[model samples]
Target: MKVLAIASAGGHWIQLLRLMPAFEQHEIIFASTRQSFSETVSSYKFYAVPDANRWNKFKLIYMGAAISRLVLAVKPDIVVTTGAAPGLMGLLAGKLFGAKTIWVDSIANVEKLSLSGRLALLFADRTYTQWEGLATPKVHYHGNVLS
Candidate 1:
């Protein structure tokens, strides 16, 4: 399977990395906010998209366009993210392009889903929370990267 894994920097990126073992057999393409972040996953394909947050509408728009282009070009069978803003953009593009989408909420958000996680529940094919207590009919808790 072709998997497009998207996430922002920091904890979101770290959480995504922790799940790399699960995708070992798949062809994985990664997207993040900075090229420096690529160093950690040097063995895999990586692309850098503009970084944006909920408060930055202009950057978010730019990121959305960039992510859309990447998604169309990569044409992945599945799109997965542990995210902030970039993941949401990937999910939106993946959904529009008919790719299955998975949203893994960051482990840091123990008390509640991140804003992106909540938004992902609207469209992501599968939504996961690290904390089992956060599971609901719409969100699931199978396992976590931390475990």
Candidate 2:
């Protein structure tokens, strides 16, 4: 399976990386908003995308376009993210391309899902929360990066 793993920098990126072992048998492509993260994913195919947030509408649009193009080019079988905004863009693009999408809400958001996580629930094929209490009929809890 071809898997595209995407996330923003900092904790989001760390959370995504923690799940790397789960995709070890698959061909994985990594993406992050910060170029510095390239070093961490040096062993795998990686792409750098623009950092964006709800406060920056224009950048978000640009990121959406870039992610869309990347998703089309890679044509991954699955797209997964531990997100902020960039992850949302990837998930949206993945869904549009008919790739199965998984959204793993950041572990930091123990009380509630982040805004991007909630948005992902609208389209992501599978939505997960690290905290079991946060799981609902739609969102699931099957373990976490910390574990």
Candidate 3:
């Protein structure tokens, strides 16, 4: 399997890395907003994308375009993320191109699914919340990366 594992910086990136073992059997491609993160996954492919948020409309568009390009270029069999907006862009792009997509809500969002997670529910093939209580019929809880 070819997996595109992506996230934003900070906690989102950390959580995505924690899921690395799950991709060990496959070819994994990593992506994030920080180019420096390439050092962390030096053995695999890494892409640096623009960072965006709900507050930044123009940057969000750029991020979506960048992510879309990456997905088209890589054509991953699956796209998984612990997200912010960048990861959501990946999920959507992956979906549009026939790749299965997963959205793993961050452990920090204990009370609710993050905004990106909610948006992802519409497109991702599967959606999960780190907190079990947050799981619904559509959102699943299958443990957490932080654990």
Candidate 4:
């Protein structure tokens, strides 16, 4: 299986890195905004898309175009993400291109759902929540991400 692991830099990237073991036998690629993330995960191709806040309309359009290109190029079997704008782009792009998508709500969102998590719920094939109490029809009790 070809898996596309997506996240923003910092903690989101760190959390995504932990899932690397789950797909060791399969081909994997990564997508994030930071160049250091690409350097750190050099074994696979790393894609970068714009990281726009809700205010930046132009950047959002740019990111959407990047997402389209990414889906066409990778054609992954599965798309996985840790919450953040860039990660959300990957999840949506993967779904548009016919990949099974799994989204992990950021560990930072202990009690509340982040913006990305809410968006993920609309399209993700499966959405995992690390916090035990955030029950919702879109969420799965996956236990703590660090555990």
Candidate 5:
């Protein structure tokens, strides 16, 4: 099974990297925003997407397009993400392209989700919360792999 691992940057990227072992046997693709590690991540099959924040319409549209292209190209069997806006876009695109999706809310979102997590819940085939307290029908209580 092919897998696409996605995140934003900084902490989320570190978290996604930790989960890499889970899908090592599969074809892997990585994506995140352009950050200091941009060049580093490029060593793998990585993609650049716009980073969406509280309010960034242009970045959001660019990210959506980038995700569409990446999804079509990689054609992953599954998509997994650690929260942030870009990851949410990937999850949506993955589902649209007929891939199973997994969304892991960042440890930073223990008490409440970031905006991306909200969007993820609507599209992710399985949504996970690092904190047990945040567990809901749509969220599983998974301990933080990033921690």
Candidate 6:
């Protein structure tokens, strides 16, 4: 199976990497905001998308377009992300391109779902929260990556 795994920098990226073992035996491509991250997953395909946050409309549009292009090119069977805004964009792109999408919310949001997480629940095929307390009927709790 071909899988596209994406995330923003820092904690989101780290959590995404920790899920790699589950994707063993598949062709996995990595995407992130930092070109420097290509070194982290040197064995697999990698692409860099422009970084953007909710507050920046122009950069957000640019980032979303870049992610859409990447999704169309990869045509992955599944798209998975540990997110900030970029990863949510990835899920939306993947969904539009006929891929199953999964979003794993960053473990840092302890008290509530992050803003992106709330939006992701509407689109992602499967949504996960690292904290059990955050799980709802639609969202799931499967422990955490950061320990």
Across residues 11-39, which tens digit of lDDT does each residue of candidate 4 receive? 99899998898889999998888867788
- Score each candidate by Cα lDDT: 0.94, 0.94, 0.95, 0.85, 0.84, 0.94
Summing lDDT over every window of 10 consecutive residues in candidate 4, give the lowest-scoring window: 136-145
Expressed as tens digits, the lDDT of each residue in 35-120 for candidate 2 is 88889988999999988788988988999999999999999999999998999999999999999999999888989999999999
Worst 10 residues of 5 by lDDT: 34-43
**What lDDT tens digits, residue by residue, belong to model 3 across residues 40-73?**
9999999999998989899889889989999999
Better of 2 and 4 by TM-score: 2
lDDT of 5 by residue, 60-102 (tens): 8987888889889999999999968788888999999999999
**How close is each model in CA RMSD to the real structure?**
0.8, 0.8, 0.7, 1.3, 1.8, 0.6
Off by over 4 Å in 2: none
Model 6 lDDT tens row, 88-113: 99999999999999999999999988
Model 1 residue 115 CA deviation in Å: 0.9
- In model 3, where do residues sit more than 4 Å from their true spots? none
From the highest TM-score down, the ranking of the candidates is 6, 3, 2, 1, 4, 5
- TM match of model 3 to true structure: 0.98
Supply the TM-score for candidate 6: 0.98
Model 1 per-residue lDDT at 83: 90
lDDT of 2: 0.94
The better candidate by lDDT, 4 or 6, is 6
Better of 2 and 6 by TM-score: 6
CA lDDT of 146 in candidate 4? 79
| Global fold similarity of model 2 (TM-score) | 0.97
